[model samples]
Target: MSTLAAMIAADYGTIGDILRERARETPERLAVVMETGEAVTYAQFDALADRVAAALQRDGIQPGEAVAVCALSSIPYAALFLGALRAGVAVAPIAPSSTPGAIAGMVADCGARLFFLDAGVAEAQKPAPVPARQIALDGSAVGEAFDAWLAPEGATPAPVEIGPKHPFNIIYSSGTTGTPKGIVQSHGMRWKHIFVGDTIGYAHAPVSLLSTPLYSNTTLVCFFPTLAGGGTVVLMKKFDVVRYLELAQTHRVTHTMLVPVQYRRLMEHPDFDRYDLSSTRMKFCTSAPFSAELKGEVLRRWRGGLVEYFGMTEGGGTCILMAHEHPDKLHTVGRPAPGHDIRLIDEDGREVGPGVVGEIVGRSASMMNGYHGRADKTAEATWTSPEGLSFIRTGDVGRFDEDGFLTLMDRKKDMIISGGFNIYPSDLEAVLATHPAVVEAAVVGVPSDAWGETPVAFVAARGQADPEAIRAFVNDKVGKTQRLAEVRFVDALPRSHIGKVLKRELRETWQKSPTT
Candidate 1:
């Protein structure tokens, strides 16, 4: 395997360099299209980005500063992102779906100096600590719009020299908890992961669908790889079933990086076959795996490259199942990508054999520097072994097959041990989702009087899923202990922006409910 240095031998030093190089190479290539239906070519994007950088500098945001963007997917957003990178500023993408308190916490955590707000969205979203100024992305103040402010009079800000180690972003994790700590990504890992993504599992994929929100680390898997390869990005503001299929066909979308629920929705769409998906080549499912049954359903309808990966934002875009390599078909997340060292170790930190389910650990050029501003958590996640490998504990129970395929069995903290049997929520959820009427399923261990921890099933049904039928369905499929103690037939499951069923919320909700 080539070293990361060899991989980046001809690399551009910083994000600014990549922007300039793209502009020089393909000045007229369409770079981004906004929600308002405006398109900007490479030349236009770079120029306006320079203007935003200068405008920001004029407002006292200098190199290496932090900026919070509380806007929806728009043309102005693309410009703002580029400008932040060009000006050597870090970006925090605050989603509209987040509450005002959450937005404030994130912006405050990143310590943004100035926020470029889209009032319609930002006013609704209301990012915290509200930056020094709130410049609008759209709407004119006395006929002077954001673009007019960027009259291109000021020269592009001088490039700030950055090593691979300089921080690129302080991305917060998806789940809203007590406080979301930032994930610090280094400049080195940012580009390294992009390159690894292009060659490891996905090639220079053209026209990837951004149906998933732009606020995720998974978004990095889609957005940067295409941008680096000079391919087109088919952006979607939100998930609309028909629009997804239509755009995929219209743009001849070659790739899609989405969560499992999104894939399930695509397959369940009434108008699934209304457009041709022959051009769709790769599908990436990794923020929680879709059931193999769901993958089969998806492939049956849309058929293309199907790959699953297992990794967190903290782990970087490091682990993957390469296209066309199907060994442990449904169980494994596949082998380690090049330059990544991975292992499964027991509780005492000793290496476990291939079949022994233990905690998965890894190290790579792509691992985050550390979780931002939390040393104790950082120490818990990342540590160095005697052999000098920078090991990161995945907190996922996994094992490698003799055939070298890697499988995730369960999360260490998420496992339910009852009556001497261990059960993974994913395993139970998979069994539950296969039932005819189950639209969504979340399995969490609730307190049990007899067993230390016991599994309870919470389901969101589609057409006719009542508690009895669904409980019988799961009981018939999984082991006796895996059967739900009680089932909650809720109208809908709590979901994050990218649509992973928020089991944490469901667990809390179920705890308070007398029915469960």
Candidate 2:
């Protein structure tokens, strides 16, 4: 085995082992810091995790069992996650924004014997049923306090053999309920992400400021790498543009991960240029459609390497666009990362030639094992090639340019079939975004009498933009078959927790409206 591989196998095979190593190497170094000024040193954090793991083991929670946590970002919350992994248990971090029913469903779906929540979450989800054994991160009447629930200090749980294929965590789909699919990421996948940080300069004692929720994979992508590299991670419970800039400047944060919406807000902030963001070394964006314009603006203004990652949480394949390096290729997500095999296939499962739009299917080292407890659904997501190699089917439709960069067209479900002509909403939305008066735009297909479905646009205007005029401008730019059926002005487009435009919600709202 290679020298690095041998070291990893000996001392840092799992998340728990790595944390233990860091604690022993740099006990005084700060491991995590929250916006509220709370911080944990490596030694203290590791001991706290030991206590938590011991407590879980005392409660008869066996290895490979799942522990669910639904709370705002906090120091204790981070400890709980590490503690579960330390004991060979899987941590399931559910979205705090989910409805009570959805929260309950996710906790149950993970088969968690212990549920952890903050006072606010417990109060908000009082109506939802939880596990018999519950603990509160923030002292609340709903459950036992975190300090009280932990085992004695310095007490450690018995360690179990951790293999590469062992499940590390189960991340439930956002805004999902009624048999929510849990994406099971294995230890090997996470290890790959952690060690690969060396190549990206994450091992240079980088300090990452994570503004997104802990439940999001987007946040974890930076969070785990920062800690694994023996650096500090600053957490933010919620994102506020002013506060974010203040913290980034104060901490001299070198790295961060943000979705596209957050980037837009930061750029549009009136005092965005006032802050000294020179300390930032790398800034990553993902989880939504990042426009070429936005990428250009950040590359011009932001003092860092701006990268855009295009992939799914299921982890089939990832394409990285280094905006600072590939200034001309801003319109496309970069070529597949090393070891990622990507291909385009038509609806009938036939391979499409270069430049032909088709659904993207990919296979990679980081791919998930499968959906938890749903073999049928898992099988549906996998597409077997003529060579019998399996690949994960990304529901996105895109075409590869001659340069090998992938330009996303639209989601398969979002494609509008108007009079038998396929229209990509992104094409119309891109034109709408070019208008000076339009801040942002989203297009969705609506049921029509004459056509099978027609495209309708919802736009957030920058100034006094007439809906009719905006519609006319966009219609003139697009093809006749892809012209907008109607245009509606809104203060903002509806978005999910991760900044993805909620087109499904828009369709439902439009269908129920009198104008439609």
Candidate 3:
């Protein structure tokens, strides 16, 4: 078996070193697989990644250029990721199922220079007016059928030094108040996260099944942490409640990162009893806090094993519920990860003692270098401390108990987290505002019996706008989670001049409205 070149070593200067090292040592090891049973081993993955880099270089893809992967989660998607990073391309994977308008907006916002997409999307993508080197994934992307171009036909990418300070990727956050901002993450930022797939649970656990979208930060923060230590990553192309349980029993999967909604679905799935989750050693739930009763149900179903981790895309983890911790504390996100100093501070940044819920502020290497091109937002989020720790102001509201475990209370942003998905009311508002009949729009998370918090839109229209029409517009335009459960028109939208729609006011008005 051809292993990754042992001669190549990490000098701590480049970001691609991670995959290179893995490829060098265990080229035959499975790096990633798809539901169709296609697999990419380290050597093959590396070679394919090399092809992607070569293709980019053929057109003079300079280091530090932004390359966006518009393909779905597949072997090609993985190649584009590692290949781009190795070539010093800032990676951002756009959802292929998304609408062309949203995709175009994302491309324009990120300034993507190259696009790797499927033939079905190529024509639709070209009209987006993006200046990019576009390529079709079908004929050229690496897979089992294989592309001959994956073999070196030209000079291979010369290893470049990626530093702790260099930006590795830029993932967009749905701006609840305005246009979505790209959060730029650095290689140093990712390496500094103390907990993830590899961190030892009180007792060692193995065999993790990943159901989170590979592009989401949860995958990077939870799964990559394990891959860093050479842990196996079992992929599920998409979540299927039946298959999820079967895989657990079949593989004896010990670890997984579950969203609260997925957890609820698993808990409610009829097939859960047909298989054995008894082998599940540790389960970490995030995106939103799991209820105490739900935690108990999860522990009871999985046999007393459930924990939680609190984190965001813009910063490192706030806390983790370790296996060693209390069951009563299951609802709490345990103390901050090492190297992160977490605190609950009020509006002025004054530290609030235990039990006072406030926006969580944390400092760590896992924090973003900055929100890409949004300097004003970046300065507000990041603060340089005299002690040398760069503190990240996490926008969520939570507090530490006397035991040091964190209790999540309310969120400060109108960010609707449904099924572990963040749906920005403002992003939807912006999309809806473009409608000719729409005079104003406000989105809020109404109490959902199923999805924890489902987004509902309240609109004021000048002429006429069908709720179903608006929902269809957004449903086709965004990720599945961003879909509105329902839409209702109001007489007027409450706004605070500067003409900003006061989301909090709208939320309260919706909560009390008879039409609600």
Overall lDDT per candidate, in order of appearance: 0.72, 0.88, 0.67
The candidate 2 region of ten consecutive residues with least summed lDDT is 3-12
**Best candidate per TM-score, number?**
2
How far residue 510's Cα lies from its native spot in candidate 1, in Å, is 1.3
Q: Which ten-residue region of model 3 has the weakest summed lDDT? A: 2-11
Instruction: List candidate 2 segments past 4 Å from native.
Output: 1-12, 176-179, 514-516
TM-score per candidate: 0.90, 0.97, 0.73
Q: For candidate 3, lDDT tens digit of each residue in 27-81?
A: 7877675655677776776677777777666667677667776654567766777
TM-score, candidate number 1: 0.90
For residue 422, give model 1's deviation from the true position in Å: 2.9
In candidate 3 the C-alpha lDDT for residue 71 amounts to: 59
**How many clashes show up per model?**
2, 0, 6
Instruction: Please write out the lDDT profile of model 2 over residues 136-202, one tens digit for every residue.
Output: 8887777889999999988998977877778889998775213568999888888877876776768
Please tell me which model should have the higher lDDT, number 2 or number 3: 2
